[model samples]
Target: MPNMGRKLRVGMVGGGGPANFFGGPHRRGILIDNSAELTAGALRSNPDDAIASARDLFFTRGYGDWRSMIAEEAKRDDGIDYVTIVTPNDAHFGPAVAAAEAGMGVLCEKPLVMNLDEARTLHQAVKTAGVPFVVAYTYTAFPMVMMARHMVADGKVGEVRKVEAWYPQGWLAGSRESTADAAGQKQASWRVDPSKSGASGCGGDIGTHAYEFVRFVAGLTATRVRARLKTFVPGRALDDDFTVLADLDNGGVATIAASQVTIGAQNDNGFRVVGTEGTLEWSITDHNNLKYYRAGEPVHVYRLGGMYNYFPSTITPFIRVPEGHPEGFHEAMANLHRCLEWQIRAKLGEQVPDHMHLPGIADGVAGMAFLDAAVRSGRQDGEWVDVEPVG
Candidate 1:
C-alpha cells in the first residue's frame, strides 16, 4: 500500500433530485473529511434534472445516463475511484452494479436494494470484483454510538440479555393531510409504491436502521423474528408501522419497532441494551451523551469526546473536543466519510488509518434478510420466522 498525494476523484449516481434530504449533508461530509472530490455524477433519474443538479452541486462534469458516466470516466487518465448511489430503493442496484463493473469502489445508501434477491446479487458482484464497498448505515458513525458499541464489546455491559430499539417519525401520522398537496404527494408517492420502494415501506426505510443499530452495538445476530406490520392510514399503499421480536444467536432477545405515524416524534431514533451487569442507552436526539449503568451504582454519563477511563481505541478519532462541545449529526456523517476515504486509499494501494472501518456488504446482506424475514413473519400473523444467516 502506497500513499498518494492527491485526493480520490469521485462520482455520484442519484443524489440530485427532489427526493434528497440527506444529499446535501453527504456532500458536505466529503468536503469536511477532506477525503474525496465530486468529479462527476449522473445526479438524477431524469436526464434534465440530472444535468441541472450537476451544475448546481458543482460537479466538474455531468452525464444524463449513469452508464455513460462510468464509460467515460473509466477511459479518463484520472478516473473516479468511487461512485456513490443515493437513489430510491429500486434504483440502487443498477447504478451500484455499473459502478462496480467499471472498477470503482461504491458507497450506497441503506437497505442495499429493493429486496433480498437484489441485495444478494449486488453483494456477490461487489465481492467478485473485490472492490471496497460500504452500506451507509449512518448511525454506526456516531461518536457516542461508537462508544456504546465499545462498552458492550469490552465486556463493560457483561453478557447481553435483551435489547430494544425504535425509530419514530410523525411525518405520516395523517397521510391525507400530509400528502394532500402536490409537493407532499410527490414525496410520499414512490415511497409507498411497491414498484419503486419494494415490499416493505417504513420497515425497509427506518426499521432497518433500528435493527442495524442494535446489531452493531450488541455484536449479536438475530436468528429468528416474529413481527406485526400494519398500515394505519386509509388508502396508504404500504405498511407504515412495525413491531418485531427477535431471537438472537447468543440466546438473547431484541424488540424493534419503527413508525412514520408516531405523532409529535421527529427522528426519534434510539436504543437501549441490558446485560447481566449493566445497561447502555443512546439516542440521535441527544447525540453527545451515552448513559451507562452498573448494578448498585450511580449512573455514569459518557459525554462525547469526554475523558473516560475505559474508552476503546476504535472510538477516539470521532471525538474532536473534550466533553460537551456537542458533536452532532454532521460529525457522525463525517466519520463515515473518513472511513470510506481511508478504505478507498487502501484500495488505491495506500496504508489505511487504524480507525477506518465501516459496515460493508455483509451488513447489507443481513439487513435484507432481516427485512425479508420480518415481512414474512408479520404476514404470517407474528409467527416466528427463521432468518437465514449471511456469511
Candidate 2:
C-alpha cells in the first residue's frame, strides 16, 4: 500500500470536555505539527460528551467505549494507524495493552499504569507485540531540558553527586475544595480518589515528572528509595504529600518531594542537580530559563531562544519562536509528538531521525518501580527500599 504523502491517522481515547487532563494536551500535541490526523476518537466516558468532544475537535464520530473505538478503527480499510491514551491514571492500562495486542503504535500518559505489576505487563506486551510505545514524560521534551541532558552527557555537570527535585501544588491545599473547583477548570477530580488515581496521589501524578527530570538531567538511575507519604485532606484516600530520598545507580543521592497540599505552591515544579564540579537547575516557575552554576564560576542563565546562541545544535529544532518569545507546556508536548512522528515513520520503513529522546517503555516501567518503592518505603516509616530492576 502506498502510504506516502499522507499524515498518520490517529484515534484518541478520553480527552473529553469539562476535563482538560492529559487528553487535551495529547490532542493538541498530536495535531500541532499538522503531520498527523485525528480521524477517530473515544473522547469521553459519557456518550454525549464523547460525541460533543469529537465533533468539537472535528474527529469523526466519537465513541463512548474506548475498546469499541479501537476495535472498530482496526477493522476499517482506512482505520487509525495508531492510538493515544489520554485517560486518567488508572484508565491507561486497558487501552494501551489492547492497542499493543492489536499491533498498533501506542502513546500513553505517565505513571504508565496504576502499579508496578501493570507496568511490567504493559511493558512485556508492547515489547512482545513489537509496537512503538512511549510514556508521556512531557517535561523532558522541553528544549532547555534536552540541553541539560546534553550538558550532563557531555560532562558539563561533572560526576553527579546529589539531586533535589519537586512538583508542588496549592490547589489542593485545603481539605474541602476539589481540584476542578479550585482551578475553575477541568482539573483531575479522580486524583484524590484512590480507586481512580491509585495509592499515591500527588507523587504518581507529578512526582514521576520530578524523578524523571532528575534522571534525564543528571544521567543517574535510581536504585533505591526511602519515602514518607502524607494525606492532609480529611477524607482523601491517597497521599497528597510525599518526600523521598533515593540512591542513584551512579552512587548519587536524590531528595524528591511531590505535594498537592502545600500552601501557595501552584505548579512549582523543578529540579537542581549538584555534581562534584557544579550544579544545574530548572523549574516551571521560570519556564523559559535554566540556571547553571559551576563552583568557581558565576551563575549563568539560559533561555529558550535561537539568538542566545549558546545551546547545542540539537536544541535548535525544538526552538519554536524568537528569543523573547517563550515556549512552555504545549511546545514540550509537541516536541515529543514530533519525535514520535518520526518514530512512527521509522516503523513504516522510512528513515527518520536517530536516537529519539522521548521516554519509552523502560522509562515508564522504571517510573512505576520508583512509585512502588516510595510507597513501600513510606509504609515502613521511611525504610529504604530497592527499586526493582526491570529487564
Using TM-score as the measure, which candidate wins? 1
Kindly list the per-residue Cα lDDT of model 1 for residues 1-391, writing each as its tens digit. 2355688888888878755766777787777756578999898878888888999999989899798899999999998888887777888999888888878888888888999888888888888888888788898888878878888988988999999999999888887435557646666777788888888989988999999987789988899999998999998888999889999989999999999899999989999999998999998888788899998999998876646545666667666667647777777777777777777776667776567367888898899999999999988999999998786
Lowest summed lDDT window (length 10), candidate 1:
176-185
Q: What root-mean-square deviation over C-alphas does model 2 reach?
A: 2.7
Q: Tell me the tens digit of each residue's lDDT in model 2 across 1-391.
A: 1234578888888877664566777778888877888888888888877877898888965787788888988888888878888877888999999988888888888878999999999999999998888778898888888878887888888999999999998877775435436444235457777777887888899899999987778777789999999988787788889899999998889999998888889889888988877788988878888889987789988888877778776677677788989888898888877776677788888766444367888889988889999999999999989999987
Clashes of each: 1, 0
Q: Which stretches of candidate 1 lie over 4 Å from their true place?
A: 1-4, 176-183, 306-310
Q: How much is the lDDT of residue 361 in candidate 1?
A: 81
**Could you give me the TM-score of model 2 versus the true structure?**
0.93
- For model 2, the local distance difference test gives 0.82
For each candidate, what TM-score against the reference? 0.95, 0.93
Judge candidate 2 at residue 92 and give its lDDT: 93
Residue pairs with backbone atoms closer than 3 Å in model 2 (clashes): none
